[model samples]
Target: MNAVTRIGQVGEKAVFRRHHRKPDGRSLFLYGFAKPDGVSLPEGNDPVAKGGELRWHPFRREWNVYAAHRQNRTFKPSSAEDPLAPSKPGGAVTEIPFETFEVAVFGNKFTSLHPEAPDPPEIPGVSSQPAVGACEVVVYTPEQTGSLYTVGQERRRLLLSAWNDRYEALFQQGCAFVMPFESRGEEVGVTLHHPHGQIYGFGEVPQVQRQMASAFDDGFSLERLLPQWSEYSVDEAGGVSAFCPPFARFPFEVWLTPRRRVPGPWDFSEEESDGFAHLLGEVTRRYDRFFGRDTAYMLTLHAAPKGCEQTFHFTAQFYPILRAPGRVKFLASVEQGTGVFTVDVMPEEAARTLRAQ
Candidate 1:
């Protein structure tokens, strides 16, 4: 069984949503400009996968999830076997049941975390607990081709709205930290070719988030930092600004944030959200245009923890892996071992090149 409902409007476009339960009991959500129709709920059952546990990393003071099951997850399947594609009416059933939709989000079949995760087993000298969290796949389109930048502005707005919905829903479900990130291209180890992103609802604030909160508490100001890097500013529109930080750790690293911080996407006013969607598309377009190809990069959203909203600033950081066209910047011993990144291109140079694009 399935149900479609109008979830209000994002800008001038009307957004409709539908909820479905896969045969294996995983959750699936469909969002589009129109109310989805002719939905087919397939019968039969698949084995439900188990979730993993989190272990304490004593030296790093962080939790690491151990999900051996993830080894069997789908990896670079052929176009015909793309599991993210919408299920055909009488053909093989995939994640989505409908033949078409603007954007689809579903519980990851090979998630590293789970809501019903079992308690961790006792291991001598290791502190462990249930990896009680959530992982989801946010499909940008049903076409299975093109990048998020090619999805166009209307779809991008819908995507941001979908993300906002998920962020709020996850927080209400007890997620301490909710992150929506995209790992694009093969260089970033993206297993799927589809234009999609993932959202991870961590049970606790991760190390970087904790550090960011501390930094903000110490009076580290984005307002001050923006002026210092004014020369590296790439684009600004609708209250959102994208710029390369002077201390950029990657070659073409760019960060996008609102002029004024507001905890997360959920707190964004209508204008801020619209501007964010537009600037996000612009930045990705510039990256592809500058490199003359689909650039591989890590796109991450950093928001305040559930209760520490006022103390944190929301930002989106894009770390493109390419130092130059057709060349990849690999994280070597110095970076992985010592957490010190050696950037090949200066922020000013990279910004100038991107601006020309």
Candidate 2:
């Protein structure tokens, strides 16, 4: 059900997110124009989409008209067997000789959110919460590349570079917390074949973030988060670091810790960005090579606690999906009914397997 098959044929595919809402208010995303590769616009230009007219359907309450030049794709609710089980984890590992760094950088123009998605909310949190930060996405590719050989050092650079640039832009707009995230379909239960990532900027933190902060306190700051991973530290104050915990929910899951104690993505230095990107490539490439084919996983950025002091550490987690090749670990009553996550495979075992490759 990926866009690969949906492309070329044309018509229209609407991606519907029933629970997630935008500030302007809309529950549907109808995508039909399969955009060309290596595309990006200047500061003021938008990517070329299909369709002949640019309009919004009153009945549908969504963007309408315009025959997009890109492929068409429709979105359906992911059946974790329930309408509410929308938390999909994408942590696949593939190494398919991804597009060059330059091409990958511009490739993101195809995603639904343009660099010019209007002005972000001044504060963060859902409208239900009133004031807080904003969130967005950054797709990694047009094809699945979370698995072996698909993403390497060069591609990782582009990914991080795009993130770094976007972070700065958000900061200039009076942003306080910039949360960068990636939601490749494999982990998110996406039926499409497109590859992309996301970025979020906000002036305050969300509720879920406040909870994480209250639970752990150790002079936790964004900078210190990066270094935590590299040193595998139980305590630290700043720089770049990464760590794989023994209590990981998934065997291959990794937590990236930064050294500085900043609020969000904009805190990164140029060299730090490059270094982090390379390190990310190293870690993910191992996973991709280990999987041998495309892999499934999700990456989430945790930086700066919301509506509080910057005492929280910045950390990103890599959540992989798949109990084994051809055998997926589905969430039964245990996970669905309760939040208790059962790690079917041991963390050591997964790390060894990944390292061996």
Candidate 3:
């Protein structure tokens, strides 16, 4: 079956991919464009070509990227100069040159990793790599301002399809792990206010993801806990479930899982993809209702490594940082120092609030 609507080239190294979904009997457009552009890729900061370095932390036994060049990325621009928007008629060129498009994806001007780069200079005690990986931007809409939750069902479905395509493409390029996520609101330190998300294709598995893989290796079955572990089940359709886990670190955290075990987004059945999109939109709506306004949050997908699909269960987690309408939840000393999160509201209570909304 034909899945992608349109596939073409944008700027250098950028690929434009679009898809459509007929939801509620109406067709909607969702397009994604990927490219690499820099208003300021001054001499030494081009991570893709040079100076992209990764260092191994001996104590943590993990890899950390040292791309100081990302400090110069685009920050808070006026609506007229929104870089994520499509290039308007007779207007300053933005990342996308196309005038009107539903959705777009492109390479991030500032990325922690690079898709291709030379190996970093090795040290005696420290191991290092070239920080080679891919970071692409996914714009949800052409509108300058709006939350992803406010987008229509068809758009959300298209977004899911786009993500699946990216995951598949990135994996084929030899990325070990792929993460598609969003950071919303100023509190989350989102520099540009545009409605967009990002996908990071890592050459090596991240630490947190490594831990999840370890759990599966130890015979922990997330499938077994799916039926009973959720304190608040938000939506269960097409063998997919969205719920608030009892051990949630964030007050209003939600997890999405498929009833049947699947390795990654690429493994999702058509029915499961539709249901997943529906639940995603539903949960976002509930978040807005609970807060009585736009909610600042972070959304992330954790999938199994490229080769370890059968053992690991792919899941999506949404972390809304707002405790009240105007109040925000700040991770203080304890959360940062000890890595133990102390939540003010219980997951059960958070679920109740969401359900009521």
Candidate 4:
């Protein structure tokens, strides 16, 4: 029978995973996409043919996995008399078909939907009429058998690592700005619980993205300093190191820095990608385990816009909103109308919880 591991002492996925210390140490976990309806793992290492695999979403640049939808994937505390709390027994894993796409450039321009967005939302940091503005999606895993948080760290990192492959190709095709934004689980407001979807593009920068770029005046250089920074903590193939600001904003949010400074996703090389695969797996799994496994999440990429290689730092920002069993910090008056945020739990506390896993 195909085997699946459960969370451990701390009730988190990390407890079940042992980080490797060699270049190939992270790849030690034998991960294969599981087939649906109690099917087994595929014969080869071919990711596309695996039953429980992850692939890219063409519309959004984010990744999706093939796993069974968990029973408590959604968040509707008021739905039933006793709703599913953050801590509960999740459903069995779901598996689905896996598909990956080659890199391509897409624009919001000239598409059938262009006239429809006739007026894109007037964001604060971007231009209303810019040279380019497009959006696309990428699905990572198709293993519909488990919640996104249930996948092993090795597999998770590999799935995230795919971005390096396509980002380089897409940037060449004229994509100036790309951000994979994602929301998971129905209870937490995710539309699909079936492992999938994210968005990106080649065009005018989103207002927020432009503002973030302006944070640095001296143009950065991924070419000059990326190699050393991509995976700061990992030199050996299977290192157990991770990177990020010691103080982060959210629980278990991790940034993969293979080289010292990557201007953006397009500049990441093979080393960065491999490190990302390992780290991402570690981070995602820990997030769910943080709030009683299978927690919902959202991750964002903070990188240099297509042309501004000199002005930005290519970093990822993972936003996992699940604070506890049944509570989330509501974005009330102070946060909604006004652009401010406050967290009840300190980021350090969140980090500690995650690291424990």
Name the best candidate (by TM-score).
1
TM-score of 3: 0.85
State residue 110's C-alpha deviation in candidate 2, in Å: 13
- Deviation from truth (RMSD, Å), model 1: 1.4
Q: Which stretches of candidate 4 lie over 4 Å from their true place?
A: 1-132, 147-162, 168-173, 218-253
lDDT of 2 by residue, 1-357 (tens): 011112111113211111212222321111212222221111223333311322333443333222243344334423222211111233121111122122122222223333233332333421212222233434454433342125555545545545655555566765665666655445565644544555655444445676667755645344433433333332222245545566787656766655555445446665555556655655666656666646677778776643444466556787767666655666679877666789887765665566555
User: Estimated TM-score per prediction?
Assistant: 0.96, 0.55, 0.85, 0.56
lDDT of 3 at 90: 72
Model 3: clashing residue pairs? Answer: 14-34, 14-35, 31-103, 32-105, 33-105, 34-106, 35-107, 114-133
Clashes counted in candidate 2 amount to 98
Q: Please give the lDDT score for candidate 3.
A: 0.75
Error of 4 at 97 (Å): 9.5
* lDDT measured at residue 105 in model 4 versus the true structure, 0 to 100: 17
> The CA-based lDDT of model 1 is what?
0.87
lDDT of 4 by residue, 21-42 (tens): 1121111111123211222222
Give the Å error, residue 137, model 3.
Answer: 0.5
What's the lDDT for candidate 2?
0.46
lDDT of 1 by residue, 1-357 (tens): 578888768877789888887778887888888887755646446675657999999998999999998998889998887888877767776777777888999898888888888898899999999998899999999997887678887888899878988888899999999999999999999999989999999998999999999999889889767766779999888888899988899999999988786778878888888788888888999999888899999999998988888868899999999999888999999899888999999999999888888
Output the better candidate (1/3) by lDDT: 1
By lDDT, rank the candidates, best first: 1, 3, 2, 4
